[model samples]
Target: MMQKKAVDSVMEKIIAQDLEHKELESNFWTMSNHKWALLAWASAELDQSAALVHLDWHWDGINDFREPESRGELSALASLDELREMIADRDRPVDYASFIAPAILFGLIDEVHFYCLQDDTTPGLSSDLLDETRAKEYRHHNIDDLLRTTAKLSKPILFDLDIDLFNRATPFYLDGPEYHERIRSFLGKCSDLIQRAAVVTIAKSPSNYWIKNEGHYDWDEELAGELFNEIVPIVR
Candidate 1:
């Protein structure tokens, strides 16, 4: 685990928006912050035409607001303001579930390689709302296929990892040693291609209505810390 000061310093580089230290310590902080931090970090660090490798249990590719029609052609060089406008809805500015859709629509990501538990043909992988080009840029893979394929990615990569990818069960019920090994091995394979990375460790909360885990409301700060430690050195 990083010392508080070290973690704060790293976060300072990644978070382009204002966020209080107290909020970082809170388990109930907005999930959008986590997603945006990764986007901000990648925007600042990577070259053009970077690829986003999203590893999660759920496909976060939903175009919830359908901003593409009005936004027109979104350039990869889009400003943060433009990106913000593309994601905004009347009730909320950016939703965790739908943030990736805006990222794709805004051309922040040239290509998306999604690794999930489900097959490529699953309903969650459907890109019915996206235009043809955007839909073609998306490729799906099974989570466990990382080890089987020797495919190499030429473009710089932004790794978007959600902790829930490890298991559907509550964090309390997770197999700690096995999860650590899996994370370590998977990251080891992809580290060479990664330019930056973002990790989301969400604790089930009422505000996040999508998460159905009915366990305790406590955040898995320890697991987050462990994953952060494992990731930071490789990306840095």
Candidate 2:
């Protein structure tokens, strides 16, 4: 496992909004950050029409890393040392890790469709799943539902805007220098995504959608957000 400065790790998860979403959720300090073999999810074969996006973010110590607030009660800020102490307690290891990790499930996303954003259907794959599940297996999903599903997780779709920051700090929340590295890896994984595309499973009932990948990683999520804010879609 690649070790990082505890401060950077905390900042990474904070920027990515990768922390626990609920007060009664699991613990996170002893959690293990996942690695994706440094693969790229997008490839040169990507359709031209695909919108180029940019993402950037910084720490607020408030709002729980949620979207920017114009005016309201701000959340409390967490110091690097304090976050570390809470996470280091051995008794809370499992709870801590699960608290801020990518919740794993065997559930299915039915009626999921796909829509090639480009003019031509690029025969490529996606690594979103791979980043979460190390296996290279892919299942065919509903292209139409995947594309046309305007609603994201029972919430209204957000469009006509740039830069989306979720509740958790994702890899996208890292800084410029590190963000470049992430893009390189994501770009390199495009080939794998293309291959996995054919095998991805898509269910049609109830139209299930699994969002959020593994997180609370050691990488600085704030920097990542600043770097790749454009690539991630806003799930409002």
Candidate 3:
């Protein structure tokens, strides 16, 4: 049995606060948000030129905030100061929707293999921003394909998992016990390649921003705890 007590103390506190609110707004813009914090943590642990195995519902690789021309110039940013200036110009240094773009621009990630759920909606990447070399570096595959092909990779992986990938509407969705089992099985299969991992559990709250207002799911303490229990061991 996955122990709820095993959840991180800080996460436990956050969930406790979330339970008190009727609808916790998505705080992806904030530096204190778990998404940014986890990415920051992963960035610190991962070496330059590491492969990021991004498993999520959304593409999240787009340069949405900046214009195509401006983003195309990111390759020219040689120093950390230049990169900081670029991000600061957008007024959002680290946004969840476009963090991967900056990470790639800054050479934090050399390759990104996106494993998204099977859906009709095709997310497009800016052609101007990604030239031939960079375009070849980014590849998209369905989740099932990822499961089948991930075992073949010998390279060190930075596993980036978004819980929303297993949205309630998807076949991967399950109650706590089954969800735990599936995650364990999946991670066990890819454990050898995973050098470090980051997990993001989004509740999909009502947002005035670009995000769609899907009726929020209550992924409070119980679900968060279960997920934490399963993920912590593999990543650690």
Best by lDDT: 3
| Model 1 lDDT per residue over 1-236, tens place | 99999989966644432221112421212232334433453344345555666666566665554465343534443575655444333244345555665555555565667766533434343455455445334445654454233146555555565555544243324454765676567667766444233322232211232232324444454444455456544433
Which candidate number would show the highest TM-score if scored against the true structure? 3
Candidates 2 and 3, the one with greater TM-score: 3
C-alpha lDDT values of all predictions:
0.47, 0.24, 0.49
Instruction: Give the CA lDDT, 0 to 100, for residue 32 in model 2.
Output: 18
Ranking by TM-score: 3, 1, 2
**What's the lDDT for residue 116 in model 3?**
66
Which ranges of candidate 1 are over 4 A from the true structure? 1-32, 45-47, 67-78, 81-90, 118-126, 135-151, 168-176, 195-236
The residue-by-residue lDDT of candidate 2 on 95-171, one tens digit each, is 21121111111111111122212222322223443244332221223223333333232311111111222212433
Ranking 1 against 3 by lDDT, winner: 3
Give candidate 2 misplaced runs (Cα > 4 Å).
1-182, 198-221, 228-236
lDDT, residue 201, model 2: 12
TM-score of each: 0.56, 0.19, 0.58
What is the C-alpha lDDT profile of model 3 across 21-79, one tens digit per residue?
Answer: 11122211112222342244233444435566776666765565365665566656565
Clashes of each: 0, 71, 0
